[model samples]
Target: MHGHGNVPGMDAASEVGVDVRWSETLRTYHAVSNELEHELQAGHGLGLSDFELLKALCRCCAPDKGTVLMKDLEAEMYLSQSAFSRTVTRLEKAGFVERAACGFDRRSNFLAITDAGSERYLSAAETHRAVLDKHFG
Candidate 1:
């Protein structure tokens, strides 16, 4: 009990609703993340972060400008810059994305998804959506 009220089965820490809610949120996130990682890898040969990076780029792809700069995508990604860069490198090696120097900026680089990436993303998206629907629908 939190010393505020008695919760039948919980100790002081877990007795409070706020504490329970926070823990449940963390639990749900982990469950979803683990499943996503597993299914993406098993079915698509892609990691969860890899799928997410591809998803972000695909969503933000402009009709005129299919490329998006790292800075522009920084907000969409949950990883640190170094981690994101590493993901990009892995995707590039897998032939899913291309990293190119910006035409007008020396220090800026942009990412463009390949045709293969688009096709892969199309297949993986169904898996991603199915998982989300099962968990949160």
Candidate 2:
């Protein structure tokens, strides 16, 4: 009765344990993400989210093709709709990404990584992996 409303089998101690673990997980996520963001921005002028977007596009496309549908990219990103759109616009302006109409659906757009974008992503990916290796490996 002193803790969060009880589930059938769960107790206050269990609730506290869950909360502590969740808090730690969040803290770790933030720390790792921030470090990666700083490394990417300092080394490549790309933010973590920007690098992630480029990586997603590259993963979705073949070596000869570097395009992903806007919807698909949205599904891959953790950002809100408005934030994703803004990120895309920012990358486009930076010449790292390009948006084009989907041939099958004029209402839909496809995002493609440019040569510059691919190079940036590839370089930043090394830093990203190194950071992860340092922390999690």
Q: Tens-digit lDDT track for model 2 on 71-116?
A: 8889988889898999999999999999998888898998888889
Mind giving the per-residue lDDT tens digits that candidate 1 earns over 75-110?
799999999989999999999999889989989999
TM-score of each: 0.87, 0.88
Which residue pairs in model 2 clash with each other?
none
Best by lDDT: 1
- Please give the lDDT score for candidate 2: 0.88
Which residue pairs come into collision in candidate 1?
none
Instruction: List per-prediction Cα lDDT, in the order shown.
Output: 0.89, 0.88
Q: Say what the RMSD of model 2 is.
A: 2.2
Candidate 1, residue 88: lDDT: 92
Candidate 1 worst ten-residue window by lDDT: 1-10
The TM-score obtained by model 2 is 0.88
